[model samples]
Target: MTFNITTKNLDTFKSAFIAALLAYIFVYGFELTHFTLSIDEEPLDNFLQTLSAGRWGHALLRHYVLPEPYAPFFTTALSIIILSLSAATSSIYIGLNKLQSISFVIMLAALPQLAYQLEFSNQADTVSLSFLLSVVALFMIEKMSVIRASAFIMLTVVSLSVYQSIFLYAATLTCIRITTDAIKGQIIFRQALKKIFVFSLLITLSLIINSFLAKWTALYFDVTISNYLTSMIGWGKRDVYEVLKSVLIFMRDYLTFKSAYGINAFPFVLLSLITIIILSIKRKRGAPLIILMGFATLLSGFLLNFAIGSGMPPRAMTQIPLVFAGLFAAALVISRVRYIGLIISIIFLCIGSAASNKLFYSDFMAREADQNLSNQIITTIYNNIPNFDEKVTPVFFYGSYSPLNSWKIPSADVFGSSFFDWDGGNNRRMYMYLSTANLIKLKEPNEIQVKNSIVAAKDMPSWPNRNSIKIFDGVVVVKLSDKLSPYNR
Candidate 1:
């Protein structure tokens, strides 16, 4: 079987229209709100300020700003434009019909977790991922030319500079593209191996260039690049065993707690496997290589997690589903039962889109209620607390509070909204908001410099982590009784 590259013009207008419509519906219908201030916003805000102040060098190499360089506005918008163009080009290379491409774009635009990332996650990893995909799409679709190859290298460097985790995506896309090509007989096993070898070298080259670029850019800006890059290059306190353990845990979570994410990939991977098996039975020459490449693609995410040594939220994790979508499109184009493949792709996509919409809508309403309550309580506290800016307040929260209680109905995700949910993880921030003063966490008896304040919920007589309600040493202990506003309710 000889693989012939077929040229088909995708209805770019239809794809873009559907993508835009779905985006609008989700943004409006779900009321997905972006917060002005969040856990991750502080550094981004600082970076923006630095850029505005012409301290571009300091912004990228600022203290406590690690994990990636900060070039938000330019990188983000450029990435989005590149991604859109990449999608359009992919439709032609993969021989996707207008409907198929539209569905793919809709999934890209509407997946709830990805939507959450775009709305919240500070756009660093997400936009970097977009850049990585664009690199893959452009490289795969365009005929190899000196200029084109150089452009791919440049984009690849930019993608890596933005986020080191992009190596995971770069590897995943390369595997899928190579496997898809082999399955389509566009390349034999030898050619597929050569492509993989060349892609690996490109990634290595990109990593080296990005490091020099990061240091060079920092020097140009008169900033210092921290030793954090050492860890990013897979050298840190976490040993290989520890990293492997974390990766295993992450994999387990993906199959259970994060299974909805895996839904998009698992089915498509299975279909690809079955397709390869059938083709192998028919004496196909490159089926085994396709199988190997497909497995490599599946494991790429885990390897990335190990390298990062932490579990990332949906924003970064969405790369897996996107890779799965690309593989599905490639497989659909080449399958004998193309209609059946398309139907499965459509069904999986519809499920993912519906789940994403429902997840966000429920989270949106919860956030609205939480925000209102938070504002009211903070304002009330502000009104009552004296010397609000000059004192220290230690808060002990009573009563079990959960975001699930804020929803009008049972919320779509049991995990709760990332930004709105106030659990043990964020109790300190909420307390700071409530007190409007300096916060001091009391582990044991300690001397108070400023006025010591204590706050408890309405039903706080019996709660874990409770401090004594009795006033002592001129500490102003305030109990938010039932007589005050209904905060605990």
Candidate 2:
């Protein structure tokens, strides 16, 4: 007998292992992998900075997610909570047979676009999926009963309190229930209905509590902080196409194998095909519509972003791909296209996701500044400030998300808790520290109304590699063109 090992098979398996490792790394290093929001690492970072600044008041709203008129938790916080749950469930999937294990992992991975709601986009989304998948795996592995399936369905929807991913959870659960004839028996339906009802009630309560807490926090911080809000009064009525065009440009930043934004266009469509495949196998038809609606929900959310505001970036459509990628993987496994097909599916996801990481996150991970001008200016202040709490040091910026305030500057806000767009509060310290764009605007910002706001010694913009100061009444007013610089501009 002769045995041979092919490099191709080894290579495929090795790559798969490494790919999973990369995802694990990204889970923890998410903060360094994405551009995040302009103000900071999205609201979660701002909320944390608020907490660091002893401004817990604003931190609450900075972390939750919910329907309109009700903020549940900041995207970051939601991601964390959901991811944790999914990971815990993954542990449960372990020790199972290959078919069951793969099924669980595949289904858990193909979830809604709830992960990017925070720092580690895929992690939390995977986690939420794990919970739903766990129930399915349990049904497949243990004493399967209609009551257990129905109860699991209710818990999956109700306990999570995130409606965005609910469609996937609902569809997947219903499929298992009806097709397996586990929970679809009309007599059993009544029990499942009660469970769902109770779950819904609990979800509403959670949302209500979260909303109340977040609103209280923001309001409290608003009192002590003065923020400047640039009035784009006419921005509301500006041409939607222009904004859409601009948004598209920004999103383009994520494509080209440089980032993880494009490619969602096709996968989204593929989801429909996969949905059909899955439905055909299962005796359940209603479940597929539920899954399709899940995609629609994410699309509607993204579309709303474009219609109401300026244009959206094609990259913003990432959520579509992310969720569909999950669905695609599940469909592939369930499709039973031989083990060979399964291998190919994983390969595609690995390569595509890796390319995205490189494109959208390279600058962030590298911390490579586009220009030295912003650096020159911030460096000047940090180096020149004398005796800040016994050190000749200056803090670069202050925000609710920052760690420390600069004592070198008199009346310096320790955190940017108060920033632009406040009607009335205590953020005069921030407006004093202007961006290069604001420095050259000519019109004195009416927002700087605080009594003793620091005088910028260099209001002029400075470019990377060249630093000069233009001071009027001790306020720096010179302009250097380094807007392309990374970190802060």
Candidate 3:
């Protein structure tokens, strides 16, 4: 097919418009409902605060991923960059033709699980993934028009400066890998290896540019030296076949249903993708596209899980489908399917999932109410102290501790949300470990003082450890330990 600029532009516009609708809906819904953003606002606030203070790298070094001089360099720099770009690109896409614009826009919205992250982190994650996707998108553009050299360079530079650094780099490499690898038998194996080596050099060059921009911040705290090292040792090697099966299960279970989340996200995306994959293989051999999309989705989860999480982190796990589906849509037309079978199937599944989730939202609201109650109880307890520190502190529980050295305080959430780096792993580990470790960390000094003060007041119950949780039906508020008197009683 020869080029048809007029029709192509229309496609771009439509795709961008769809992207904007979903992004805005997701963002506003959470804000209106007043659900906590999954990730804390404090980190970005802190980083921006650092920027305000005339220290560009310091904020990223100290708090971007893990306050470094501790954790590896600004590995998450790629994510942060992509997220901001996605947000910015949202507007740029609006004026574009329906297909081009909507394809980019929708892909931005779907990639990186920004909607889900927004429920907790607001728009920060969205910004990061946006940039990462832009890189992939631009790379495709480059294939058609090498004149886009400047644009590609600019996007790559921006990608290195933020948090999506690892996945962006890894995905790019995987794309190059799959492309060169596909022809190994067709081309001489030696020649294919030579092409791969050239791409490998290109990947390294990209990372070097990143190092120059971010000063190789990840190098500051070597992974070998960090505490997450203990975790890496525990999690074993990767097998590609196992990853693919897991990917299949992830699709069918989570994504098809409207309210599907994490482990439940796979069905809608995979079912749809399968249709495209068949088309790609038979007619277009868009295998490279599929491989890269799959790599981005799956590799993002794996890299984040190993580097930051325990294992099988749901939030991290969820991003695979979003990124894959968007890219898959770009290569095919779901609406063009003979009749409307494909589109209808996806819609039916989404609605079904939404129905099952109605009851969950009510409980979610109640969870909010319980959190409010627990806050009041904790505040009341705080007043008994003769001395008070205006600054807040994180309190962990159950004798667990943080990986980094933190200012000694009454409460320090070592592994909790703000501090958690787990890309995607068991949610419980993040909460439980941080809560318990912080309390254990605090109890060493404040236990006797806190206990004596409470006993003298004759209002509070005896604590089992220096920490305890003020529990509601849906939320757990970790506070002083009280085995003898449960907060509910």
Candidate 4:
């Protein structure tokens, strides 16, 4: 059987091809095959929690059915499929040229932090965000029949429930549509009001639905949903000044391209914004909406970052990158000199892609080095200390050194901490190291000490008796300070 080719079908094929190609580059460049669970990945607990609570089914499949170390590849591949659909629908809905769509794909593929999420961080958001994007694309492209509209609403609810960052995408798309209409003078006051009301109503409905579901789940589990709600709202009360500071820091990091490696995205960001403004003005239709788009873009990033609370470790700025990419694509499509815009966009995309690859490559290497160091230290302790296999192993590390670069890791955050932080054994971080190394079945420390100062009897290696070096009975003190090396010791 021969397949008929239409413009829409052709566009879909092109979008899928470009998206798949981009995903392949990202997977190979980031070394996606070498994935390992971080300290926070507790497969059994995650499975029980979601399966029992009745949440996103994809997340449940990821945690329960998929095998460790390679589960990420499956989930990531699923994300690529979703990304392809979203891209195809977006190109059709927005009337983007092939060049613009390719540029969008390149921009998307080069985001450095996204590599971190796909390769290292938990992918609950990956599936959630991908679903959200697909729904948004469908909503935009499809005719607004009652059945289609209802389907969009249902899909939106599920995506929102999985992760609230879906709000950023919703807000960004709505802003773009409204702004485009406003610029064309086609949006009436009543239509504008209706659009705002409908969007707000859908979101409010989703929130209520999520709340009831969460409440029911909490009740089943014999817990309160208030804490979960509170955590989502803010760790505590939102400090306006603190939130602003965080937004600024996020912008600086993204624009300046400041990473562990010195490569930055400032030039790309600057050029993208400049092209957006120029094209917007040249169109003369959407000039006013450009300001609104700018505001929406900033708000998108701020909201996404704020949702994460304390850590602005680059990965949290997920929606923002995609929004910027959308803006760049929009600019390319609308520019008076489309070819010129394409050239500049291509330059930026190439720069971003190279930087993205290098940044993730270095980070992955550093993480591996840290893991090796931790393994060696654990082996040494298991062999040397008497009763090491009998009692709980509590290690107090003061400093860290990466075997790869010999660069000093901060005392507060080290790669070795993942052995405890991510692995399923309590929040303490040491049990994971012991368990992964095929060490003894000694239990984790029972007491949760919030403050410093511990009194441990067993000492390993050249440990000091300083106050910083807290020791407890049946615990081993493992000094992470300099002059500490597996080979040297």
Candidate 5:
């Protein structure tokens, strides 16, 4: 009997894995095969050379999975495999039936946030592994023995260390399990409350431990924790009431498609929720609990936003997709009209896949435009600057380039942004791009030289003008724009 059960589990995992793999291939085949570069990946040529920036778990995983010089195909393929494994594990742990399991993996693969995360292909596998660990930790939380609890904490800590945003993913999963089990009559309301309390306490403990470990890791690496992560939380930075209001407003915007990317999942989420509610009411078991938990599941997507007292990028809002997947799964399990649920899931998958294709195609076009502009600037600099030696001439970029390209396709965040226009990293990105392309080895200007170039660039013309590419104080200053704001400088 044990062997038979093991075989069944393996078969379930295999089925889910195949479903997820096919879904991702349909959505991201172009990105997997094509050499695509996003703003962040432009300067991130060597993965190991980069600092951990408080993401020690991601750093460690990248050390093993991604070494040096980004390989688009390899990184993308590995990411797909890891994410498919995560989907399979989730399906097995959640006790999803065959149809629901297929729906779950399909929705997971079609998530827009996953597409955005893959934009930074160098660390995509690490992020995917973090996601897998988050799901695994939640799955382990179901039994809640001493050993399992310890494993849960360890997994949660590692997941957060790799990528903090996935904590919301785990939290949403926990809420989904509690709510769904209660509604399905698998667990009483009292049992649901107890599980919630236990899971919350363990998750809180894991977070505290993660915080301490992060601080220790920073010290050990001789690196100061980046304020980007630390400052995201609004413990003392925001008023309590103000933060609450902002979080609610942000959630409303996100759900209503006011603040979303590509194809919005709001319609599908609403349909799934309605289906679940109607099915639960018909059964008349834990109907009130189902309604309350349904709301909780919806709110779980923005739990991190509530904690941080602000909004986040599309990649950070991964829980939204997870929420959609859970709702669809719940509806599938309870509804007599399983075909309706399956059809909705398939439609969502097709829409999301189409959007993913358009997004990648736009990104490819943007990269081409950026490369053309870079080449033009390089040629102009070499021709205009008398005896310009790239090895010796210190190059400083003042301001940023905003090319007129078709890449601006209504993205909710940084997905469509160009490397040349990435604020505060224009010079580094350009230098790395040139070096990686073997076009030139431009010398990077020091702090003082950069400051001087900024000051001198105020009087110079922007790009396409004769005075845009000029030598200022023995440093080549390429003023891509006239507005030299301190933020971009």
Candidate 6:
């Protein structure tokens, strides 16, 4: 009996894995096969650099998926496999039937947030591993004992150390689990609350331990923790209110198919929710509690944004897939229309795949445009300077490039934005691009030179103008725009 049970479990996992893998391939195949680089990934050509950001787990595991010779293809494949494993683990932990499992995995693959995470291809595998770890922690803590709780805490810390956003993923999973168990009568409402309380305590403990370890690791490595996330933390009333409002607006936009980074399955999601509600009313269960828990599970994805008192990028909203999956799963369980649910899942998968391909195409075009502009600038520098390579010509960019009219596609966060956009790191990004291309050896201007160049560039013409490229005091100053922001200056 044990052998048969183990074999059955393994087969279920395999089926879930295969379903997830196919769904992911259908949606993100273009990205996995192509070499695409986002702004943050530009500096991660041959090495992983998240250690300084206290992402020791990411830094350590990223070594295995580092894109060396094959560029992005290998890393993308590995990342997809890890993400499929996460889906499989989640399927088993949730105890979904085969059809429900397929629906869940399909929904997971169709997540727009997953696409955003893949944009940073170098870290994609590590992020996927972090997600898998979060699911595993949830699975281990199902029968919470002393040993299980300790293991769950350790796993939670490791997942958070890999990517801080995954805490939301794990928490969202807990919320979904509680709601499902309560609705299915597998656990009473009181037991569900107790489980939630225990899970919350463990998660909190894990967070504290992770925070301290991150600080200690940074200190030991003599590296400063990146303020990218920390700088956003605050309890200011106005900002807090704005973030809360934005969260609601984001949900509305997403559900209405108005959000740029939302899966095009709002109709399906709406239908599923309606079905769940109807079934709850028919069953005469605690409909109010189920509704409340369901909403909490959905909102849990954005809990980090509320805690930080700011908006987060789509990549940080990684639990979005889980939200939709849980909704669909609930509908599948309560409603007799299982085939309809499967059909809707297939439709969602198709739409998501189409969207992913569109995004990949847009990114490809953006990279091409960026490269062409860089090459044009390089050529102009060589032509104008004549002795460009003879001496150290420190390049100073006065303003940043905006692909407003240059590209036809609408920008979605960092998806279609130029690398040279006014993000306060345009100069460094440009330098990195040029260096990586091996087209030209350019020197970065010092702080004083950059300041002086900005002042001098005030009188210079913008790009496409003959006077835009000029040399002053052996520094090559390229003025991209006549208008300069305080950040660029």
Off by over 4 Å in 1: 1-7, 10-84, 93-113, 124-129, 136-149, 216-246, 252-268, 306-311, 379-489
lDDT of 2 at 140: 31
lDDT of 3: 0.37
lDDT of 2 by residue, 327-394 (tens): 44334433444465445445444554453343334323222221232345455543543222212212
In order of appearance, the predictions have TM-scores of 0.67, 0.46, 0.51, 0.74, 0.93, 0.92
Against the correct fold, how does model 6 do in TM-score?
A: 0.92
User: Order of candidates by lDDT, top first?
Assistant: 5, 6, 4, 1, 3, 2
Global CA lDDT of candidate 1, please? Answer: 0.49
RMSD in order of candidates: 7.9, 12.8, 11.2, 6.5, 2.5, 2.8
Going through the candidates in the order shown, the clash numbers are 2, 59, 83, 10, 0, 0
Candidate 4 collision pairs: 39-422, 39-423, 40-422, 257-264, 420-429, 454-471, 455-471, 455-472, 456-471, 456-472
Q: What is the C-alpha lDDT of each candidate?
A: 0.49, 0.34, 0.37, 0.50, 0.77, 0.75
* Residues 1-489, model 6: lDDT tens digits: 001236667787888899999999888888887777766765643332476677876665555645432256877898889999999888777667777787888887876568888877767887888999999898666666899899999999999988887878878877777666657767667876787788889989998999898888777767677877777765564666676787677666667776555454643566766776777878877776677677787677668766876666667767777888877887777664577777878887887888877787677778788778877888898889888862377988877776542433453667776776747436777777666656565787888888888888889998877579999877888988866656555
Candidate that scores best on lDDT: 5
What is the per-residue lDDT of model 3 for residues 232-298, given as tens digits with 9 covering 90 to 100?
3323444655545554454334445432232234344565446645654665444555444444443
State the TM-score for model 5: 0.93
lDDT of 5 by residue, 1-489 (tens): 001247768877888899999998888888888867776775553433334466777766665656543576888898889989988887776677667788788887666668878877867888888889998887666666999899999998998887777877877887777666766577777877887888889878988998888778767767666667667776577788887887888777777777657547654687778887887888887888887788788888888887778877777787877888887787777774556656766787888888887788778888788778888988899788978888788998777777767767875466566777877446777777777666677898888898888888888888878579999788998988876545545
Error of 4 at 108 (Å): 2.0
At residue 452, give the lDDT of candidate 2.
16
Worst 10 residues of 3 by lDDT: 407-416
Query: Residues 250-292, candidate 1, lDDT per residue (tens digit)?
Result: 6776645445432433434546556655765475577677667
Backbone clashes in model 4: 10
Q: Candidate 4 lDDT, tens digit per residue, 247-295?
A: 5675666566454322255335556557667666776765656655645
